[model samples]
Target chain A: MRNQLPLIIVFATGLLVIVTFFIPHEPFGSLEQRFLVWYSIVAGFTMLLGLDSLVRYHLIKIRDRRSGWGYSLVLLSGLFVTLILGFYSWARYQSPFKLGSPFMYLYSYVIIPLQATMFALLAFFIASAAYRAFRARTTAATLLLVSAVLVMLGRVPLGGWLWQKIVSLIDLLPGTNLSGLKGLEVFARISDWIMDVPQTAAKRGIYIGIVLGGIAMSLRIILGIERSYTSGS
Target chain B: MIVNIIGTWIAAGLTIAILSFLYKDNPLYKFAEHLYVGVSAGFGVIYVWAFDLKPMLIDRFIENQGVERWILLVPAVLGLLMLSRWFGKIGYLSRLPLAFTVGIGAGLGITASIQGFLLPQIQATLLPLTTINNIILVVGVITTILYFYFSRDFKGPFKYLLELGIIFIMVSFGASFGYTVMARISLLIGRIFFLLSDWLRII
Candidate 1:
């Protein structure tokens, strides 16, 4: 009965949602929104479960005097301090996100900069990868390299200046009639086309497959065939 | 004003600390990383309480009357039951809430996939083959879909179609990569701007 009850609940709720999708009656019409509200509230508690796991891990590391326990100490201190400030802000101002609040200050200074810098670090890594891996060794590789370069050029201001200079140089050469097709606009047009037609086609093909797979998986879950959730995986 | 200046300097120091990881993994980067995880988690807890629980559940329960007020108890109970997982004995009870969430998720996925993804994508793909672009679009979609069809060995013309599909896929990936690189570069630029303009007053 341990597993069966959950499975039954899954089936009932799944079927209920599916059935109500077609109905637009007064109660049923608002049912999905109502369920969404309930889901968010439940999901909010799940965040506490996550917070428990994070805190426990750090606490264990610190207790055991593990290799990076100092860092864990830093982490726990940051967490607890932020939490105190957040709750204090909420209590005093009725919103944790009030302007000029300590929580907001930490958010603006610490979180924003840290997260942005973290992602910004990826730019350097991507550049390193481009230098090593973006070789045009084969037809497919060449196509990829060419497209990437064209798109990159189409995006940046430097690309326009370079394109104009190249066009001028080409015009300087004897026996050349490049008049109207003169700037980075050509690259932009090609980039747009690449994104619009072929890219759309490929993405649509992938999306169709994903949708079909999702439907099948949903069916499996609804039927209780997919039991990974209950198994704690 | 003094507080703002101190905050800017702190932000700059953190940004520099994170950026130092590009040179080599160091203690500074590690400190920043750990602090980031903690702060983000703390923010999430407050966010969930503020946005989700406080407004949706507690406020709604307090504001509504009769059945509506009482109905909020169902989710509140389910949420509490999820917290029961922390206890060794009542952990099994958590599965009920998990099951409920999964069921709702699956139901939503089925309908949303059909309405949002499948039909729309199919409709988008169904273009007249009059123009060369249209022909390419139609053929690209068909061949790409056919590429994933591994039921039988595709010999002769089908083989070429599969190859064409891969080319289309590769082009799409290339475009995606280019866009991603640009986005990363822009983010980097933002950081640089903050460092130079906000922190150093150099720009």
Candidate 2:
């Protein structure tokens, strides 16, 4: 009963939604929005489950004097403090002190910087990963390397200037008009075309597959066929 | 004067404390991190209550007495059903709510596909192709699409055309990357200026 029920629901729901798209009936159009709100409520509650697990894990670690007990303490303490401040301020609906509160300061200065720094780390990581991948070992790799180098160069002003020079030299021959707005327009057109066509098509194909897969998965879940995410598992 | 001065000082101190993590983790960073999370959560809850729930549910459905009052019960019931997860014996009952959510999401996704993907793409393809720029665009689109066509292998001249399409794409991507990097650099510069000028009042 536990296993089969969810799968049945999932499949039924998935099929309904798929059909709903073509139907364009009154309730069908609103079906998605209704689901979104329900999902949000469920998600909000699931966050509490996460918090419970986090607290339990940290408390156990702290009790056992684990290696990173201190860090765990920091995480828990942060979680609780935030929860308290958030709840209090939300319930009261008053400024939790003056206009320029400590909370505001922490948000703008500390949190923002931390978030930005984490994102900044991606640039360095990408560079390192690209270095490893872009080795000129084979024909395909060489092509990749050449493309990578050109793209890297084309990004900079110096690289653009060099490209312009090469383009102008090529243009000296008959039939090539590579100067001013015509050149810029051609470049922009080429770039836009690449993005709109290949990138968009590939992305769309992947997205379609993902959507279909999701439908299948959702069907499985709703029909009580997939009990994996449930507690019984 | 007192509040402004104190606020600025608090901001400066917190900024330094957070930035100290760039050097390495410390007690100061931990303090700031905890405080930030707590306050952010508090504020977020308030925002949701005021902006989302108040207008949508309370004012419109309950107090303002809209026709959608009965419809509101569906979500409320679902929300209650989610709490079933907390119980051990009847936890499977949560699937009812989960099913409703999945159904709705699937419906929405299929609908959005038409507007977000199909319409925009068709509009793009319908552009005039007589001009040099338009011709380049048309060629680029066809060639790039062919580059991605893995249904069959590109032999002979087809391979060369694919190569040219790839180069154009790469150059475009490079230009985008350069712009993005400059934006990040500018942001970093701005932050530095904030520290030097507003926080320190040195300027």
Candidate 3:
């Protein structure tokens, strides 16, 4: 009954939503919105399950005196403190995310800086990888390298200045008539063309395939062929 | 004024701590990382509660009247039922809410894919191939799509098309990587600016 009931609910809910997509009538349209709202609420509550798992994991580490348990303690302390502050703000101001709230302060100062600097660290790694790994070994590799270089250069002001300098040097030649041409912005134009045409094609093709695959997977889920969600401890 | 100054200093310290990760996996970076995870998770919890539950469920339940008010009990019950995971024997009951969400997700996914992505992309791809750019775009898209079509091995001409498709894909990847690097560099620049100007008052 437990299994079958859920499957039935899945089929019913899935079918209703799918059917209502085609029939955007009075009740069906509003019903879909209501269902979405309900789903959002339910999803919000589901987040507690994740929080439980996180807290439990940290607690287990602390209990076991595991390696990096100190860090886990730090993590838990940060979490609990933030949560306490948030709830306090909620109680006091009726909004946890209110401007000038302590929660907002934490978010702005601690979270924003930590997140930004964390991602910024990747820039060094990417540059290092580009230096070591990016070689023009073959036709495909050469294309990739050239495209990357063009994009990297063209995205900034340096590419334009370099292009202009080169154009000026060429115009210094005996027979060159580069006066009629736009010199500085040529690199950017080429980069834009590459992004707009070939890049768009590649992305569009991949997106189409992904969307088609998603539809198939969604169908499988709705039909109960995909049952992995039912299996857990 | 004092609070803001204190906040800026704290932010600067955290920024430097995170940037210290570039040096090595030291204690400072580890502290920052763990704290970041905890604070982010806590923030997420508060965000979901404030944005989703409070406004959508609790507020609506309170503000509405008659049948509308009571209708919210359905989701509230389902949400409570999800807590059945904590119990051993009745843990399977949690599948109901999971199934409900999954079904809704699947239904939404299918419709959204068709309506939002698939049709629009296909329509956009069907462009008039008058210019060189258009031709390249049309051919690039076709060859890229054909490259993924693995039903049978192409003998002669289609193989070259597949190779061409790969070239386009590689270029796309390269362009994407370049853009990502630019973004990261910009972020790094922002951090430097913050350190120099906001923290040290140099710039």
Candidate 4:
């Protein structure tokens, strides 16, 4: 009965949302918003559930005295301290980041740098990878590598400085105008052409395929062919 | 002034600690990583509770004291059921919310995917083929779509079309990679600026 009830609710609510999109009127009009509200409410609880699971996993590690159990203690302490400070700060000052609040103190001092640094790590790795992978071994690879280099150079401030100097050097040797109608904005113009023509077309094709795939997948789930959402059953 | 300085020091120290992973993974990086995860999750919990649970659920139901709002108790109960995975016996009950979420997600996806992705993309491709750019755009789109078609074998002319599709796809990927490099460099620049300006006071 429990299982049946949920599936029924799913079927009904699913139909309701799909139907409401076409007919935005009356009880159904506000219904789309109401459904969205309900979805978010459920999502908030899921986040709480996630936190609970995180705490429980750490608790188990500490209890079993696993490797780096001391780190678990730090984890638990940080979690509780942050939670308390956050709610306390929110309740008192109505801002998670109110001045003189512990939440603000921890968030600003700790989280921001850690998050930024984590992503910053990617920059070094990507540069190294690009060096190896972008070697011009074949015609296609050469084209790709050249296009990438052009776009990269065109994007940065130094590219503009270098381009102007080259144009002037060339003009001294031979050329009439040195550059033509698209003189000043030459680098940006190339960048725009690359993006607008080939890139947009390719991206659009990919988008169509993705949308079609999504539609098929959604249909599969709706018809209960995709039952992987169930935990074990 | 003192507090801000101290905060900047702490942030700079942590940033350096994380960057140390580039040389070798060590205890400092692990400690910073663990602390970041725990604190962020904790912040999320409090934020959700204060902004979502307290205002949307608790106050609306209890403080307002309305009989009509009592219906919200349904989702409140369902949310609790979602927590039942912690228990061994009744863990299966969580499947209910999972099913509900999946179904609604699928339904919403069906409508929006067509509206947002399919229709607009087709509309975008319907441009006036007057300029060289327009011709390139149209040809590139058609050839690329043909590359993704799976049901048929590419024989004569289709083979060349597929070949062109591959070229377009490669250039597209190259452009994407270039932009990603730009984004990553921007992030690195941010950290460098912070270290120099805030920590060393050398901007």
Candidate 5:
């Protein structure tokens, strides 16, 4: 009974939502909105769960005197301070002395730079990973190496000069011609074609199957038939 | 004038602190990293409550007295139920919220699949192949798809053909990467220009 109930619920709700998309009526139009509201509520509650986990984990680390407990303390203290300030600010509404006033300063000076730094780390990681992957030991690797070098060159001002030289040389061939305008136009056209055609087509096929599967899954949940998310059954 | 000067100084100081990690890990970077995470999380929660829940839930339920105010009860119950996870015996109650979340997520995924993925892809592929450039695209598509076909055993000539397909894909990917790198480099250059010209007023 436990298993059957949830499964039925999921299939039913999933099917309704999918059908709702096509119907576009008073209730159907509101279906997505209702789901969003539900999502917001659930997300808010889940955040408390996340906070509990964070606090518990750090507390354990501190108790155990784990490596970097000092950092953890700093983290917990910051979290508490921020939470107090946030709630205080919200309660006071437009109060000039609200704790949340310092938040913008903290974000501008601290958070943005950290995010930028993390992204910057990607460049070094990519270089290292590419170096290992692009070894020219086989036919495939050799092709990769050549393409990488060409693309790297083609993107820069130096690449433009090189392309011009190559185009002029090709033009010199008997009864054959390649103008700079023609070359540039052809390159741009090819690039756009590559992005729009095969890439888009491949992504589309994967997406369709995913949608159908999701519908089936959601239907299983909303109808109270997919109670696997609950305990016991 | 004072605010502008202070802002410039803060920017320069933070930039230096972040850049210091590129040379080696330091206490300054660690401090900034922790402070960043803490402040960001705090601000994010506030924004969520103010922008999302305030107008959507609290205002509707309390101030406006909307008919759908009763809908707030459903989530409010679920939210209270979730707190039951803190207790050993009632922890199972938390599953109610989890199930609802998964269901909604699944519905969204189903909708997004049709809109975001399938239609655009089919349209893209079925586009005109009459032009010379389009013919190249058609060849690239067919060959690349063949290259990915894993079920059939590929012999010598077929292997060679697949290799050619792989080369085309690699070239395309490399070009994309090169473009991305150029963008990042340009951004870095822009920042340096700002520091020199606007901040210092010495360009």
Candidate 6:
């Protein structure tokens, strides 16, 4: 009964929300807005579960005295300090949190830089991957390499200079329609052509397929056939 | 101003600590990584409690101010039911809320995907067969769609069309890869600027 009730609630709310989208008048429209806000609040609640897992994971590492478990102490300290500071700052409505209150900095100084730097590390790794991966071993690979090279080059000024020189050579041939096509501008034009033509085409087809797949998956979930979320149960 | 400068230095130092991982795994990198995760999680904890739970759920309900706001109880109950997973015997109860979440998610996905992605894309693909560019775009979209069509076996011309589809897909992927490289380089530039201008104050 416990399991069945959830599924039933899922169906009820799911159908209600979908129905509300179609009927955006008066009570139903306002109800849809409320549902969205409620959804976010519920989502907010899920953070507790996430925090629980994180704490448990770190505590276990500390308890076992796992390799580099000393770092776990640093982690716990950072967590508690940040938590207390954040709450205190909010309650105080001080600088950084409230802005213009002076430099009571935590998020701006620590979290932002750390997150940005962590993501930036991907730059080095991806460049390394591209070195080995962009090999032109086949016809398609060669075309891919060419397109990538053109795009990378065309995005910068050097490609424009080189392209202008080539176009000047082509300019010797008079009666040529350089009307819409300007010298050096051709690099950007080619890049745009590749992006707007082949890229857009492939992207559209892929997006349509994705939408269909999404609809199918949604239907599966709505129909109670997709039970991956209920894995343990 | 001194506090702000000190904070910037701290941030700069930690940023370098993370970037040090490129040489090899070390304690500085581990400390930075743990600190980032722990602090971010802590921030989220405070954010949700202060912003969502207290104001939206607890205080509003306790004060009983906004009459219509009681509708929030539905999701509140559902959300609470989700936490039941921590308890073993009542764990089956969690499935109901999970089911509700899944169902709403699916419904949301269906409507949004159709409205946002599928229809607009189809509308855009209906280009005039005028220029070479248009022709290539039209053919490319058609061929790509045909490649994804799994109902039948590709024979003769269909096989060739599938090959053409792959070429288009490859080019698209290559362009995306190039753009990704550009994006990553921009990030690297950001870090370099921080190191030089902000940290070292050389540039």
Error of 4 at A130 (Å): 0.8
Q: Model 4, which residues run further than 4 Å from truth?
A: A1-6, A172-183, B62-68
Best by DockQ: 3
lDDT computed for candidate 4: 0.81
Whole-model lDDT, model 5: 0.64
Over 4 Å off in model 2, which ranges? A15-32, A91-106, A120-233, B1-61, B64-67, B132-176
Native contacts present in candidate 6, fraction: 0.74
- Evaluate residue B108 in candidate 5 and report its C-alpha lDDT on the 0 to 100 scale: 64
- Give Cα-based local distance difference scores for all models: 0.88, 0.58, 0.89, 0.81, 0.64, 0.79
Q: Against the true chain A, what TM-score does chain A of candidate 3 give?
A: 0.93
Q: What lDDT score is found at residue A68 in candidate 5? A: 77
CA error at residue B71 for candidate 4, angstroms: 1.9
For model 3, state the Cα shift of residue B67 in Å.
1.9
Tens digits of per-residue lDDT for model 1 on A86-157? 999988888989998889999999999999999999998998887665798877787777778888888888
Docking class of 1: medium
TM-score of 5: 0.77
Q: Which stretches of candidate 1 lie over 4 Å from their true place?
A: A175-179
**Could you tell me the lDDT of residue B185 within candidate 4?**
88
Candidate that beats the other on lDDT, 1 or 4, i.e. the better one:
1
**Prediction 4 TM-score vs. true:** 0.92
Report how far off residue A44 is in candidate 1 (Å).
Answer: 0.9
TM-scores for candidates 1 onward, in order: 0.97, 0.68, 0.97, 0.92, 0.77, 0.90
Worst 10 residues of 4 chain A by lDDT: A174-183
